[model samples]
Target: MNHLDHGTEVNPIKSNTKSIITDHNKDDHNAQEVKAIVRGPIPAAAVPDHMWQAVIANDRAYDGQFFYGVTSTRIFCRPSCKSRPPKKEHVFIFQHAEQALQAEFRPCKRCKPTGVRLPEQEWIDIVKTYIDDHYASPVTLNTLADISHSSPYHLQRTFKRLMGISPNAYVQEVRIQHAKERLRGTKESIADIGAKVGMDNVSYFVTLFKQKTGMTPSAYRENKASNTMNDVCTPD
Candidate 1:
């Protein structure tokens, strides 16, 4: 299978789905729900019966664990899901949204994976969309807060809390990725790519690029170009 088209290693732990949807809230069914899951490093050790009991008592056991953001429906469910379980073999688990997106998983409208709090996810969603659309433009927390209709402090914390990264850092990463994409695919000059990504100084942009990617913009372009030539000459 093509590695680009296949996502095997990231697949979630599978569970036999005797039943899918349950009427009980996950809290009420904690005992069985916890039993259904294996936390920490999988295949290393099975979760003990008492360990599951403890998880039943404390609902936050899966806080840092990888979870699958199923794309067919707008929901991010745990690997050990018993309620309305998706096909055991078809699920993907991610450590966070970054990995989920890397695997082409979209945000779930139902569970709202980004925002774990009530009424907060919607606000964060708007802010994230704004950032994605305008990442190339120079953004300040104040401007973002104004558009988000929230305070700068709130925006900063909420973004960090939900996205697992700061808004500024997210913007920078996006700009860098966008610039790299352009650099690889377009005939744009280095200065133009920098300008497109909202960097005023091309030299500064090169510095940021090197810091993040361990290579200058020109160096990266050359590498991509060489690889392209090699691929073109390789046997079919």
Candidate 2:
């Protein structure tokens, strides 16, 4: 057989076929990439005006259709939640409760949007723990209610029903217990101790201390010192 010339030109048909096959492969790759993007998580739906209206109306008809989260409170609720309607700016719409939760919003205790209600006792315990940690700050019924994501009246009633006292009472109790600890452990003045425990009014602090412990702060401090001295002097 005669040898082919080294300068022989590439076949136009074969060259064109190779280019078409390469382009086809690229197109297939691009299509696959687009499909992967489409298969990624769908974004939450935007809140429409009607959704806001539904929320304002407390329309139970829209309950499972969507959930709304309040940015200020970081709480999500069903559309029918009886709690006050949040400002439109503070609201975010989520198609599913899981999406809201994933966005770091807690389910509303009152609305129970997660289909599971938080037990009253557990909710009160959470409130109580918050008080225990923040008792040095100004704690009020409305503050506790907001932090607990319940209406003030409902929180007051449920807290009392479950804990045997109002939220404010529990806050006072926590403050007083801390005051007692500081009284026993430190020589800080009674007024300073009261202020440290969130009771800035010395007279009120003294009176409330008396009401709770049957003695003024001064008396309590003195009593603690006397007991300490007695303990130090007594034989073990």
Candidate 3:
């Protein structure tokens, strides 16, 4: 029944309590955000000393994290480059290969700081060959980058640009093709067949097979068998 000048009744105690709760929630959220910012990854450029040590050690772990351009040679290299380390005073760290290139530094032929600078077809050929050779093994972007001597980011972009499909999708296609051949020619168990094709998880393999071929591996094998029988029975 009580009303203020604007003609609206208010509970002062409840209103005050809600304001306090809202302030407390805001404070808690801000504290969490501060903690997250503090715990975030430190960018490679912030730690030149650590990067220097990585380069000196030829640590593969630091390969794509940063590159060091040597003023003496005007060349940039990944931290894991096998070439001899440049003098510390003459080296400058760059967060990306483009940054070094912008500074007029050419990519080191040894470390290949600027990936895929070769002829586009040559780069694609190298990637495709690596994929074909390692189709039966576990091939991931990082592994492919290491094998192909490029950053995972650059390798993925280049591969998708030229191949019309992501590298992983290409690997899946290769695996499925191999699986089909094995299914038609061999009497191997389904799980064994999957493992032979680099899909160790049988269920995942079955799922992928069905997705790719519109039928399960068992069904595909049965269809092949039925076709073989029909061919044998036919006079032609």
Candidate 4:
């Protein structure tokens, strides 16, 4: 009776097990389809022609559809970014913001494709800090823009608006301040000091120092020395 029971039930059990396995396989296939739809397109896939046209036209309708990165600037932007259009050859398309970033492209400060907006004051502060650190070198609007990940026009406008002076003026002020310190504390020649502060032309340096301080470097040094001596002699 035990042998008969085992033989009679084995086929039915095998049929039920196969049915369950088939259902699981169907569920897995459906899950993969859903994941593929959510992930959008593969980044390595060839860019569709319509995407390029959308970028050129600055089409806001396609903004979430794709992103384009400029190889020249290494910056990625949404289709709706209003900055100057990049050359066709320099642009690479990505299906998502994260894909562009993963490819080493920084999100555009203008469009902010990553949805994080850096505060204007904070951006200006970063520019100022860079200038302070590199004032002894030639700092131009283009160089600052490149380092700060912004356009030169925007950088100039924002920096001047917040700092009360243009970037070039700020650079001159920094250099002159350093020149003044060297003049009072060190015996370096005026020409050498000028060069050390990034103004290599002796004539131009003297002219600029007088313009900024209302006295030549030599006169300023002399005045400082005179004041120090008088203070020492009249000590309480």
Index of the highest-lDDT prediction: 2
Give the Å shift of residue 185 in candidate 1.
Answer: 1.2
Model 3 regions lying over 4 Å from their true place: 1-116
- Over 10-83, each residue of candidate 4 has an lDDT whose tens digit, in order, gives 67888999999999887666445434443543332455566667787998866676788887656788889887
- The TM-scores, one per candidate, come to 0.50, 0.61, 0.54, 0.56
Least accurate stretch of 10 residues (summed lDDT) in model 2?
35-44
How many clashes show up per model? 3, 0, 0, 0
What's the best-to-worst order under lDDT? 2, 4, 3, 1
Q: What is residue 205's positional error in candidate 4, in angstroms? A: 1.2
Question: Sort by TM-score, best first: what order?
Answer: 2, 4, 3, 1
Candidate 3, residues 15-45, lDDT tens digits: the string is 9999999998986664454344323222334
Give stretches of model 4 more than 4 Å off: 1-113
Q: Give me the candidate number with maximum TM-score.
A: 2
- lDDT by residue for model 1 (1-236), tens: 65465555542333223223342345446545543553322221343444333223333445445455433332454433333434333444455655665565554433345554336776687667878888778888876765554578878998899889988888889889998999899989999999999897999999999999999999999899999999999998
